[model samples]
Target: MMKAKQRIIILLLAGLLVLTAASCSSQKAADPATETLKLGVLSLEDILPMVVANEKGYFAEEGLTVELIPFQSTVESQSAIQSGDIDGMMNDMVVAALLKESGTDLKVTSVTLEATDERRRFAIVVSPDSDIKTVADLKGRELGISFNSIIEYTTDEMLVAAGVSPEEVNKTAIPKIPVRLEMLINNNIEAANLPDPLITFAEFNGCKTIIDDRGRSIS
Candidate 1:
């Protein structure tokens, strides 16, 4: 009798297992196929992880189809996402905030990178031969930057941190980074905010860094 009862219990448990499997199968059948996310990014070292994940098939393994769209500049990438040319982008938080303020319906899902001593991402640089050695010296000087963007925001913060008011510094709108770097090199601009690779390149070409947002959380 006890053996018969045990068998009955085992059968009931198996029935429950079958029901759960059927429910899951029906749910999966009702759901749509995995989605493909079109994400935009600039050609920067900070985006290396995304590149690696795509190369390694990690996104595929997770049931996500990712398409990485590369743009020459952050503004271009942001515009792509805003215009629905792409679904999302890797950009500065300040830019994202400005986008939201300007009525772009978007959300910041994650922070991919942070400022650190080992990974200096942004800096204010000047010609090595220039007399502007400190942030305070940047006062009343023309700093080349893409106005109303993250570069300007960071420059303002860095300058204020060094006891110089943003209003005291003259900002020149130079949207193209290469142009800004060239202007800095040729003394066409007293100073300019630059991101990695460019900052390193400028340094190699006799540019002096005034301040860097290292060990600080910009986003």
Candidate 2:
């Protein structure tokens, strides 16, 4: 019985050794330098260059088969990276900064957009007949903005520029641009801040732009 037990122990040790060797071999075979790199990306139209680079075989030329995974939001993409479901992602500075702040070992290898572009402006609009004429008038009024978005940042900047502190305004998070536009039109909210497509659409449908980067900033 002792001999049989010794033999079983030897077999288990041998199996562990074999498994270790197989794992080493598998890792060597799964070299990122030669294997596909999975990239998680947010569903933004600005990622056209990355899409083009992959479709045009630019990554393949560098011995990389980039598997592009599109997520609906940056938060979703960041979660993918944190969970090791993806190798890397194309994210904004603020998003990456937030990840770093939360103790995630994420790094930014490139800058996708200008650090400060004059064209990157977020528009603040009010209903044509709304009493609010300027950012100053937004005090105590409900302003709709998309949370964790560029529009939110620009809106804050606009408010600060107009001497209206965040404490003076009641900013609400409404994620959908269409919903924000509809609210602005139906006079449900005092004003809404969003990107050009919605801003243009709203202005076209009777919402007036109260604060826009006429010539100062990029959108």
Give RMSD to native, each candidate.
13.8, 16.7
Q: Write the per-residue lDDT of candidate 1 for residues 1-219, one digit (tens) a residue.
A: 556444443432331111011122333343123556677876566566666666766556656787888776667876776667876777776777777887777766556455776677789999867899999898888888887777888888888778999999888888777778888888778789998878999999899998999865662
- Candidate 1 worst ten-residue window by lDDT: 15-24
Model 2, span 17-98: residue lDDT tens:
1101112233445655667677776544445556666676666655677788876555677677777777777655566666
The per-residue C-alpha lDDT of model 2 at residue 84 equals 72
Backbone clashes for every candidate come to 0, 9
C-alpha lDDT (0 to 100) for residue 206 of candidate 1? 93
TM-score of each: 0.73, 0.63
RMSD of 1: 13.8
Model 2, position 40: C-alpha lDDT score: 75
- Please give the range of 10 consecutive residues that has the lowest summed lDDT in model 2: 15-24
TM-score of the candidate numbered 2? Answer: 0.63
- The whole-model C-alpha lDDT of candidate 2 against the native structure comes to 0.65
Clashes of 1: 0
